[model samples]
Target chain A: MNTLGISVDAWAAWAPGIDSPNDWNAWLAGDSCLDEGVKPNVSFVPPMYRRRLSLLGKMAVLTAQQCVDQYPIDSSLRLVFASRYGENARTVGILNNIVDDGSVSPAAFSLSVHNAIAGIFSIIHNATEPSVSVSAGQETFSAAWIEAEQILWSQMENADRVLLVYYDEPLTGDLTRFTDDIQIPFSISLMLSKSQSNGESICLQNKRALDSSDSSLNESKLNQPLSFLRLLLSPEQMISTTTSNWVWVKNSANA
Target chain B: MSDLIQEIKELIIEVLDLEDISPDEIVATEPLFVEGLGLDSIDALELGLALKNKYNVSIDAESEETKKHFSSVESLAAFVTSSR
Candidate 1:
C-alpha cells in the first residue's frame, strides 16, 4: 500500500451510460449491458461559456461540476486534468483543413490544445488555482493520481484538496483499429484531500510499485478509467490490474 | 420589421452555440460585447467569417465601421443588406 493515499471528498464520473452517481451505483450492483446515449445536460454552463466546447470538453466540465456540487471544496483548490488522447477529432479536422487549404481555423487551433478543457473548467468555476494537465500514454489515470498526491503532499499548508478530472473520447482517423472495445465517451472528477483518516472511501492502483502486478483482473487496455471503476465494484478489499503493472490494495492513509 | 434582422439573430445564436436562447430574446439594439452579450474579440472574428460565408459580405475587420456593424442584430442585418 502506498503511504500517499489521499482522501476523496467526493468523486463523480460521467460517460455515455453513467449519467448519475445513482446510475453508476446501480451498474455496480448488477447489470448486464450499460445502456448508452445519455448526453450531459450542461445547461449549468452559461451559453456564452459553452460556445467552443466539444463533447469531451462538455463531459469533463460537467462531471467536474457534479463532483464540486456534491462536496463543495475551496474554489482555489489545485486542479489536475488528464486524458489519454486529448481532442483528437478536432486536431484531425485542423490537419485536414491544412491539407485542403493552407490555413486552419483560429478557434480550432486555440481549443485543440491539451489543456483547453482544464482552461474551460477554470473559466466556468472562476477558479484561480494552479491546474496541471497530464497525458501519459495508456497510463494517464495512474499519472494523474501520482500528480494529485504530489500536489496534496507538497502543498500541505493551505492547499488541502486537488481536483483530478480525467476524460477521453475515442481517437479519430484509422487509429480506431488499435483501441480496445471502449466505444463510448467518458469523464471522471475526484476531489482528493490531504491528510485524512480513511477506510475504503477511496482506493487506487499504484504504478510505481514493482512486483505489484495483478494478472487475474480482465482489464480494458484502451480505457484506463474502467480499471478504477471495476476496482470500485469489486467485493474484495485487494485486487490487481490485467494490462498494467499495478496493484490495488485497501486505503492505508495515516494522518 | 426587417426579416433580415431576425435571421441575423438566429445566425448569431446558432454560430455562438447559445443554446436555450431564442432569436426573439436577443434585443436588436444591445451591444454584442462586454456588457450586453459578453462576446469577445474571437467571437467578432468568427461572426465576421460566418457573415462573409453566409451572406457574401466582406467585413473589413480592421476598420472601425466593422465594429459598428457587429454591434447588434439590426446593425448586422442593415450592413449585410446594404453591402449586397
Candidate 2:
C-alpha cells in the first residue's frame, strides 16, 4: 500500500551459463540460452570455507561478491538474502539421509538453515552490520526489496546502502510437482541506495490501483527473480507479477 | 598400522569434502584441526559421525581423551585399532 523510492546503485547476476554483462545482455536479447548442468566457478574462495558451500550457496555468494566488487562497499553494508527455496538440494539430502539410516551429517544439518549462506558471507567478508534472510514463496524478490527499503527508510542517516541478493534453483527429484514458478538456477544481487536525482528511480505499486485495461502491463514467463532481472535488463518500463494473494506492479519511477 | 593410518587419512578427506588435497598430502603426524588440515568444529562432528559409521567407534565428546584421539591421523588410527 505504501510507495517507496529507491535506486539500484549497482547489480550483478549469475546463472549456469550466464556470467558476464555481455552474456546477460545477449540472454536478454534472446540471442543465447542458459546452459544446463554448469556451475559458477568460485575458486577464489578458500578451500576450507569453500568446501562447506553447496551449489546454491556458491551461486548466492558469487553474485554477492561480484556485486560488491563493482560498488566496493565497506564491511558496514547491510545484507538481505532472499530465496524461494533456500538450499533445496542440501535439505533433500538430509531428508534422504534421515530416511535411509536414521543419521544425519552434522555439517549438513548445521548448514541447512535459511541463514547459512548469509552467515557465511558475513564471516568471510567480516561484515558486522545486521543482515536479514527472507523467503516469501513466489514473492521473495519483492518482499526482499520491501525489507531493504524499510531498513533504509528506518535508518536514513547511518544506513546508506543495503545489498539485496535473490537466488533460487528449480526443484528436482520428487519435489518438482509442488510449484511451477522456478525453472532455472540463478542469483541476482542489487546494491540499493536511497533514490537520487540522477539515478534510475524505482517505485513499487499494488496492481489493484491501476486500470485493468492498462496496455503497459506485461506478464512474465520466468520466475520472480528472473522476471525482475528481465525488467532490469530490458528497455521496458514496467512488469506485473502475482502470487496467490498479492499482485505487485513494479515500474520505473517516472513511468 | 600404516594401512589403518592411510585409511583414516582417506576418511578425513572424504568426510570433510577436501577436494583439493590427496591422502599422501596429509601428514599422519600433523594436526587435523586449525593448523594442518584447517578443519573447524563442524568438520569434527562430521568426521566423528563418519568414523562411527565406518569403524563403529563411539566418540565421547566431553572426554579429554577424545580430543587426543582426534588430534592426528596416527592418533585416530591408534584409537581405532585399540577400540577394535
Candidate 3:
C-alpha cells in the first residue's frame, strides 16, 4: 500500500544460450531454438571470484552482470534479487553429505543459503547500497517486481533506480522428486526507475487468474520468468500470467 | 610423484569448480590454502572426498597431520601415494 510507483527502463535475461534480444525475439516467435548442451558461459566472471558460485549462482550472476553492463547501474542502485528455489543442488548436496558423513562441506554450508548469489554480486560490485532478497513460492518473480515498486517508494528521496533480478534452477538428486519439472535454469534483471525513462512503462496489477485449474496443470510448466519475458517480447501490449492466488498482468500502456 | 601431483591438481580443479584455472597453473610445493591457491576449509573437504573417491584412500580429515597432507599439491600426492 506504500508505493510511489515505478516502471522498468531496461531489462535483460540469460538462459543457457539465449544471448541477444533478437535471439529472445526468435524464441518468443518460436522461430528459433536453443541448444540444450549449451550452458551459460559465465567466463566473464574472473576465476578468483568464480570458484565460489554454484551452477545456478553462476548463471544468476552472469545475467545480473549482463543487465548492469547494458544499463546504467552504479553504487547507489538498489538491488532486489528473488528466487523461488535457490541453490537447491548445493543445499541438497550439503544435506546428503550431512546424512552420509555426519558433516557438510564448508563451502556447501556457506553457499547453500538463498541470498548467496546476491551476496556474491554485492561483493563483486562493492555496492553497499540497500539490497533485499525475496522468496515467494510460485510467485517469486512477481514478488520481486512488487518489491521493486516498493523500492521506489522507499528511495523517494534520491529517486534511485532499483535493479530487480529473479533467478532459479531445477533441483537435483532426490529433491527433484518434490519439485515440478523445471528443466533449465534462468535469470532476469529489470532496471526500474521512478521517473519513467524513455523505455516502455509497463503496468502491473495483481489479481486472480481467469482459470484456476490450469494454474496447477503444467507438470513441466514454463518458468514464470520465461513467461514474463515472452510477454515482454510479444506484440500484444497486454498479457497476464497466473500463480495460485495472484495473476500478474503486464500492460505496456497502463499505469 | 609427478603423476600423483598431476592427478591431485586435476582433482582440485574439477571438484572445486576452478573453471579458469588449469592444472599447470598450480605450483608443486606452494601452500594450497589461503595463499597460493586461496582455497579454504570447505575446499579441503571437497578435495578429500574427490581423492577418496578416485583412489579409495582413507583420509584423517580432522587430524593435525592431515593439514600438512593438504598443504600443497606435492604433499597431497605424497599422502595419496603413501595411502595407496
Candidate closest to the true structure, highest DockQ: 2
With candidate 1 superimposed using the best TM-score fit, by how many Å does residue A170's alpha carbon deviate from the native?
2.2
- Distance from true location, Cα of A237 in model 2, Å: 1.0
Alpha carbon deviation, residue B66, candidate 2 (Å): 0.6
lDDT of 1 by residue, A70-118 (tens): 7665654888999988998889888987898665666787789999988
Give the distance in Å from residue A107's predicted Cα in candidate 3 to where it truly belongs: 2.6
DockQ scores of all models, one per candidate: 0.48, 0.94, 0.49
lDDT of each: 0.76, 0.82, 0.73
Mind giving the per-residue lDDT tens digits that candidate 2 earns over A58-168? 999999998888776675477899998898878888898899999999999989899999988888877788899999887778889889888888855368789998888
What is candidate 2's lDDT per residue for B1-84, written digit by digit as tens? 999998888888888899899999999999988998788899889999999999999899999999999899999999999998
What is the TM-score of chain A, computed separately for every candidate?
Answer: 0.84, 0.90, 0.83
Native-to-model Cα distance after best TM-score fit, residue B35 in candidate 3, in Å = 2.9
| Least well predicted 10-residue stretch by lDDT in candidate 3 chain A | A212-221
Model 1: CA > 4 A from native: A20-32, A99-103, A155-157, A173-181, A195-222, A238-240, A252-255
lDDT of 3 by residue, A1-255 (tens): 222335666788876667677888786666546655677777776676778886678778877887788675676588998988888888878888889978666667778888888888888887787788999877777788777776676636364688888888877899778776346677788878774433346545544423445443222135567776776676654444444443334434334
Model 2 spans > 4 angstroms off: A25-32, A211-213, A242-255
Q: In what order do the candidates fall by lDDT, top score first?
A: 2, 1, 3
Instruction: Give the best candidate by lDDT.
Output: 2
